[model samples]
Target: MSIADPVAVREHLLAAAAAGHPLTYSELLARLGHPFTRPRMRALCKTLAAVDDAAQADGEPELAVLVVRQSDGLPGQGWWTGSWEKHRFTGDWTGPDARLLIDRLQRQAFRYWQERAPG
Candidate 1:
């Protein structure tokens, strides 16, 4: 699959959600048959935003919240400061507050997508 394919990425993220777990960028890329690189992650982030948009349109939680950093278990800066502004977190984008919010959002995603999604 292409690196920027939002559908492919959403499937992986939903699988993680079904497991009630989060995935690191490297892990996600590997699942997609690619290696980790900043440029690739950047492109992936865009697709993630689009995926989130669709989810929001469908009244679902942001699935991208499950795609987190390996070090912090939190979404990358792109998510925190992305263009999707309805429920955007405007704080430091890190630390306790951000963690709490991200955690809540991720749990919501997990709860919504953890239905053993068909494919």
Candidate 2:
């Protein structure tokens, strides 16, 4: 299976959630044992959306939001443009407002996944 498949991406997302922090795209690439590349990032983003779709259906916080840009430590263009009703942010995808929104979602994902993880 491709590393960018939802199941593989989710394993890394679960790790980030358990660690209580966001994971950079590059960092997630490393975890998946691949070097970073735009094509890879793009592929990952597609799978991430799928993961989030499933999460939304299950009433789970989005795990994809925990995958961020290494530069800003926040999600990229795709996430910024996606539809999110639970925790919407109308501000630009930077600055305090965006950070706050991302942080809140990441924290929610962390709590949800950590609680569900088998000890």
Candidate 3:
């Protein structure tokens, strides 16, 4: 929750994702109990992306959650599974848009896992 606590933020995100519920950036900020600002959002995104990258590099591909900035003329950002296209989570960087994106992402992740699950 503290501005200096990347570990807390990382853990919070992982837990949220694992809860089998959709999550939004606003919800994430509320969980952190931190003031929301453009700079803070940027920092949080950067930190999460770094953590995901490190996990991938460590051969924990399944645990990786990628954060990407959209550059195709879309005003949004997104997260992805190890196979990015298989489970992409995207949303505008503002307001209620993130909630919709999170919902879609959760659904995609659910479908992905279900398809891969052993019968």
Candidate 4:
């Protein structure tokens, strides 16, 4: 039996997640042109789960998806909130401006977390 490719595994998983449905490792592998092998699938799922946990802890937004619509005679965009998340901001901004705002927010969050992290 051939070993599964981790790069392929990640890409498949990310694509599946982006498509709005989270798939288990077996489902991911099956979609990735392989009959799922239990050990490899387990290892891949563990690694992906750990990476996802770290990103969430660091406040890196998963999905980073923006839904846009017209509201009150202006265009607006916002993220979908669920569980522990809250939707924030509804202003219309240019693409570059949005990038700048997101970048600044990320930097601030990084610094704030660094200050709180144990050395």
Q: What C-alpha lDDT values do all the predictions have?
A: 0.85, 0.84, 0.49, 0.42
Candidate 2 minimal-lDDT segment of 10 residues: 81-90
Which tens-of-lDDT digit does each residue in 2-119 have in candidate 3?
A: 6346677656655644554434455566678866676776666656666656655764333223222233211234343323454443434444654455445555544554554455
lDDT tens digits, residue span 49-104, model 1? 89988988988788888888999888888887773376666677779988898888
Clashes of each: 0, 0, 0, 0
* Pairs clashing within candidate 3: none
Clashing pairs in 2: none
Off by over 4 Å in 1: 115-119
Candidate with more favorable, higher lDDT: 1 or 4: 1
lDDT for 49 (candidate 4) = 46
RMSD for all candidates, in order, please: 2.0, 1.6, 7.9, 12.7
For each candidate, what TM-score against the reference?
0.90, 0.90, 0.50, 0.35
Pick by TM-score: 1 or 3, better one: 1
Question: Residue 73: error of model 2 in Å?
Answer: 0.8
